[model samples]
Target: MSSAAIFVNIFALSCLVISLIKDRAKTKQSLLVAVKSFFRILPIVLIIIIFIGLLLGFVPLDLISKTMGEQAGFGGVILIASVGAILHIPALIAFPLAASLLKGGASVAAVAAFITTLTMIGTVTLPLEIKELGKKMALLRNGVSFIFAIIIALIMGMML
Candidate 1:
């Protein structure tokens, strides 16, 4: 593992120990809460892992490269962004998938756009957002997010 990861682990362990020393009951309660949250999200995590494995295993490299590679240009970035916006995958899962795509010859712009739109814009949750936040606000937020995601992708492409 990287030194940064090791340092984080050490820091977390130290914090846990300090918390336990300061308040045993509260620490126990916090651990219980953490475990419950992990279990609640476990199924989704497994599903994402399975889907990613299947995607990488079955999809042809040539096809992936053809659609998302350097040659695919701005249109490809927009296409990936739209796909990302529509898909309901969690951000944690999206990173590995994006990395895999990059390794498979996808352009940085396409990957960046995918990640940006996936996290920022939520087409799948639009109905709920509209219901809770009102139609105008929801639409405006999503529309602006979509435009900005494209701009960010273009800038990333230029810089990197």
Candidate 2:
């Protein structure tokens, strides 16, 4: 295992032990809550994993590379960014998907664009945003976010 992973595990255990020592009942309660949350999220995690597996299994590597690799350039980045903006998935789940894309030959820029846009803009929640913040504000925010997302991805591409 990686030293980083080992360190994280040790740190977590240490924290849990400390919590237990400080307040046994509270620690037990916290553990129960954490376990319940884990179970609640387990289905979503499994579904995403299966979806990713299917994506990698069915989609050709060449296609993914061609669409998001170095060859695709700015246009490809923009395309992925748009998709990201439209997707409603949680960022925690998206990280694994992004990692898989990276391993599958997606360009750094495309992946960056995807993640930045995904987190920054939310088309799925736009209706709520509009209702809460007004239409003009929501639209302006999304438009500006889209532009910045593209810029961020391009910069990452250049640096990496």
Candidate 3:
């Protein structure tokens, strides 16, 4: 297992033991609630992973790299930033995709733009965000994220 997995296991066990000692009567209920939440979200997480795997399997990374690798000044940056805006993959998928693109010769700018936008800007989650934070806030947040993603991408391209 990964170090993260080991850490999580240790943390969980420690929490369980601590809870049992501190409040034996509440331990079972706490565990049950945790399990319930996990199960509730498991399906959504599984679906996203499956979708990401499929996208990686089908899409040609070589093509992406060739297209986005161009350092055609601002045009390439715009292309990458726009593509990142369109692709709504989650963080888990974005990291792997960015790694693959990097390996396939994609520029640092493209990978950085893709990663930033993938997490900060989301069309799929926009509706929910709009409902929770109001339309104006949601719009402003996405707009700012979009601009900052490009800026970050450009910075990485220059720095790295």
Candidate 4:
């Protein structure tokens, strides 16, 4: 779990225990609600993570490195961003992958674009986002993120 999550859990449990001492009935009801929500969301999140892992497994690292190497230029950046759009990679996996790509001679622009787009935008989870946030908001956010990735790639190319 993330530090934020751990901290929240500790804080919440402390509050719950305090509440239990003050009002057992209300605390029991609140705990039931919290437990129910956790159960409902945990399985979905786990399944998505597993699916992303499987998707990542299908794409060979050598292939990505070769296709997005410095010689590929802006084409490499676009390609990497496209791949990021298709895969819902977690930050933990994405960072190490980026480092590996860098070591394999992938362009800095391509890797930067891939990492930014992978984290900021999520076409793989777009449907769920649209459902939760409305289609327009999801599209706008994703479109902005995609465009920004390209702009960042260009700047990185110029700088590095």
Q: Can you write out model 1's per-residue Cα lDDT over 37-152, one digit (the tens) per residue? A: 88988898888778778877888987888899889998899899999999988787788789889977899999999999999999889999999999999999999999999999
Those runs of model 4 whose alpha carbons end farther than 4 Å from true positions after fitting are 1-66
Give candidate 3's error at residue 5 in angstroms: 9.5
Evaluate all candidate structures by whole-model CA lDDT and list the values in order: 0.91, 0.94, 0.80, 0.81
Please give the distance, in angstroms, between residue 99's alpha carbon in candidate 1 and its true position after superposition.
1.3
> Deviation in angstroms for 47 in model 1?
3.0
Off by over 4 Å in 1: none
Model 3, 1-43: lDDT tens per residue?
9998899999999999999999987999998999998887677
Output the lDDT of residue 128, model 1.
Answer: 98
- Winner by TM-score between candidate 4 and candidate 1: 1
lDDT (tens digit, per residue) of candidate 4 on 51-132: 5566456667566567887778778889888788677756556775776677666888998898888888987788999999
Worst 10 residues of 2 by lDDT: 87-96
lDDT by residue (71-147, candidate 2, tens digit) is 99889999999999999888888988998898888999999999999999998899999999999999999999999
- Which residue runs does candidate 3 get wrong by more than 4 Å? 1-62
In terms of lDDT, the best-performing candidate is 2
| Shift in Å, residue 36, candidate 1 | 1.9
* C-alpha lDDT of residue 4 in model 3: 83
